[model samples]
Target: MSKGKAHAALTIAGSDSGGGAGIQADLKTFSALGVFGTSAITAITAQNTQDVTAVEPISNEVVAAQIKAVLDDIRIHAVKIGMLGSPALIETVAQSLKDFDGPVVLDPVMLSKSGVALLPNDAVEALVSILVPRATVLTPNLPEAAKILGEDEARGDDAVLAQGHKILDLGAKAVVMKGGHAEGETCRDWLVTPEGATHLDAPRIETRNTHGTGCTLSSAIAAELAKGADLEAALTRAHGWLHGAIQAADQIDIGHGHGPVHHFHEVWT
Candidate 1:
């Protein structure tokens, strides 16, 4: 490593006591992609693989302090954000990242893997107004898109594209709508930008080890961005990484309900 080389990526998110999602997953993804990972925890959750029992959000001032400390000391090349518990936390993060010029990957994390709601209902507006505009790429699942647009309609490629446009209209440079939760053999993800939309299709891996897929994908994208790939290229590489992670998931067992993906699949090779 060079003396002044920038090799760090920051994750602003919540803590998962289960170690399957949020900051835990983000840091694991970063390390798997060979980047130093830093974190600013927004909230703490008492969760297991099956459910989230409790949540306690950290103070806004502490969140701001963590961001400032990391930014001032480390050379952060990219950022991946997830699970802002409340409107106040969202606004605090927005203020902290107002001048950061790195690649920002925003994962619109609304619910836990166990179907527990992680974000507050009123925080959606604050996230759109404060953080969406500053994101280099925003990753949202179908349900999150529905919540953002305030619609109860079923999501397809066309509907997701329209919602992506709505997200872009809100000020994101690009939008990635993940179709894993959709019904199909193929999990199709769309990356919509000002130029046009590019579709990424991959066969959905049928497994119970999908607890942190969203967090892993976004963090992998940020790691690729830190390595100097373009937006589309980063997304493509992230897709590949996530596919491997899922395929190798069966090699280990962590929790009884839904386990985490294998982040060290290539380490022994």
Candidate 2:
């Protein structure tokens, strides 16, 4: 390890009491990838892997303060944005990052697998108009992409590239469309940059412990970016890391429901 310096990645998102997702998943993934992690919680949820029972959004002022506190003191190398609860949060978060030049991975977390709504309906508009353009990399699953684009659906091999471009037009340096929702033996994620597009595929690991895959993946990408990886390299490495975690998910039984992927698979192996 380096003598005094540490690569830092900040997660601005919600908190999951169950610790399977949200800031919990993000920070855990960061530590697993050897990055110093910080967080500004936008919402607090009484949630387990199976269900999200309650949600309370923090005040926009406080969210701004938490981000400022970290930015003022720490030299954050990357920032991962996730699960902003409202339009106010979307606006404030964008304002906070408007000046930051570091890598920013925005995960458009719209719903919980248990059918809980993470981002409010109105906030979707703000996310598109405000945060999308500022993001260094935008990550959205199939359903989330449809919601943001006001489309009914996005599936199929061609839908991946089409959806990625439509999202790229929404304003991001690049887009990574996650394929977990699509039906197939293989899950494909496409990375679309201005120059071109590249895709990665992996056999889907069937399990209920897929609770926090999105948050973990985005946070891992931010961690790699904090370590100065290029966009393609960061996504490739992050994808492989998430695959390992998911494959090793059953190694522990944390909760009774969907459970969580093993974030420290590499560390404690």
**lDDT of each model, Cα atoms only?**
0.90, 0.92
Determine the backbone clash count of candidate 1. 0
Let me know the TM-score candidate 2 reaches against the reference structure.
0.98
lDDT of candidate 2 over 154-226, digit per residue (tens): 7686877887898889889999999988898899999998899999999999888999999999999999999
| 1-269 per-residue lDDT for model 1 (tens digits) | 56767588999999999998899999999998888999999998998788889999899999999999999999899999998988888888988998899999999999888889888789999998889999999999889988987986446777888988988999999999888889989999999999999999999888999889999999999999998899999999999889898988888888898998888776745
Candidate 2 clash pair list:
none
Estimated TM-score for each candidate: 0.96, 0.98
- Evaluate residue 109 in candidate 2 and report its C-alpha lDDT on the 0 to 100 scale: 96
Index of the highest-TM-score prediction: 2
Residue pairs with colliding backbones in model 1 are: none
